[model samples]
Target: MTADPSSGAAHDALAGSLKRTEIQRAPLSVAGREIVQVRTEIPPGVESGWHIHPGEEVGYIVAGTVEMRIAGRPTLLLQAGDGFLIPPRVPHNARDLGPGVGEMLSTYLVEVGQPLAAFTEPPDSASR
Candidate 1:
């Protein structure tokens, strides 16, 4: 409900270096819904803690490679321009894998009839 906390620190991007500016908290249906256009930047050798989401995920690697793991499965390395899709409620996580940094556009979709609230973050019990 509060404004999204800014990244504060700088990170690399597809076009050039960037700083986190905004994360538009979005709504999703039970099956899922796409996320708003919130930009992301990751620094070289840096990674985020594993986390989960309520919606199914589909993404395109806009720049660089990413190591993706669904349900804690073996990581699949994705390169720039590559795309992937994850089923709903399937625990998954990804980290920038290419040298320097990487970028991607992510989306989650929901089937007809599902409530939008179902599209949200994982249960409080998940890791960060």
Candidate 2:
């Protein structure tokens, strides 16, 4: 699916932090599902705010270093050649921890008509 630049103010707000380039999108054999591939670039010290996907996301770190924080799980320190998976609706965030830009390739199997990702309040925010 193509991202509409003028989609909404929320999307524009999120885009300011992380750069996401859609690589390909195709319909999946499963009814009501589609696969979307994206290349994301994160600047040093930037964190992808906590968010949830409509389905599952399979991602591979392509460059630099990153820390993956999935709610309820131990944080993972990843580098190029490392891969991770996020189950449907699980809140997670990726932070660039690098001397240079960090890049990741993510492929998602998601339900059609829903945004690929939806940002949410941090899981631990309630305690703050």
Candidate 3:
């Protein structure tokens, strides 16, 4: 497929919106294990709140640009074709940094019954 000239770039745009679609979900052979695949679209300036997944998450940027922040790690600027992994319970968040909507496909390996994500208090608020 021919990539759009602007697919991997970020654009200056106002805060927009996010949409998610579940591609698939299935139970794994390992007891209590499950896998989930999802597609997400984030409009300019939209961001997921600081949160954690109950399991490991791996994803690939499909289009546009995303800014990701993971605890203790340098912020990442991901573009189309970029891929990433977030370990279970690691706090992180992603924002669309685009002139167009940012898109991604994510797969998660998790324990059955665990919620997909859990929002958390900011680091400074933890001590309160």
Candidate 4:
């Protein structure tokens, strides 16, 4: 296993300028694989622009609420204790629906050298 290679570049490219803390990160026991655990705080009404992950993302809502919309799915409103998944390379977006800030804990299974996420334009509905 090797050290995590994410260097905050993905967060810098996030749409709504959310704050992120790397809670736990380590390369998977398997060669060339890694798992990144991050806690993100989204300010009220802020939305992450469309983005895609290089790998699958599994997340848990920890505080407040969020509206998550994947390219081809209806918006899902998630509250604390809720869980969600974003499939690899699928474009999606999210917004904080909060009286205060919204928080979430997320884990990603990615290739060791891949960026955590990549910003992108929303996928056309017809092609989604």
Could you say which candidate leads in TM-score? 2
Q: Candidate 1, clashing residue pairs?
A: 28-116, 32-109, 32-110
On lDDT, the candidate that comes out on top is: 2
How much lDDT does each candidate structure score?
Answer: 0.52, 0.85, 0.76, 0.80
Candidate 3 structure quality by residue, lDDT tens digits, 7-119: 43221121123566666778978888888787778889888777787789999999999998887677889999999999998888788998999999989898887667677
- Report the alpha-carbon TM-score of model 2 versus the true structure: 0.88
Report the lDDT tens digits of candidate 2 across residue range 61-98. Answer: 99999999988888899999999999999988899998
Residue 66 of model 3 has an lDDT of 97
Per-candidate TM-scores read 0.57, 0.88, 0.81, 0.85
Alpha-carbon shift of residue 50 in model 2 (angstroms) = 0.5
**Residue pairs in steric clash, candidate 2?**
none
Model 1 segments more than 4 A misplaced = 1-35, 110-128
Error of 3 at 54 (Å): 0.6
Superior candidate under TM-score, 2 versus 4 = 2
Worst 10 residues of 3 by lDDT: 8-17
> Residue 121 lDDT in model 4?
82
In candidate 4, what are the lDDT values of residues 9-102, reduced to their tens digit? 2243662378777766788877888888887889999987788887889999999899998987878999999999999999998889888799
| Model 2 lDDT, residue 18, Cα | 88
Q: What is the lDDT of candidate 1?
A: 0.52
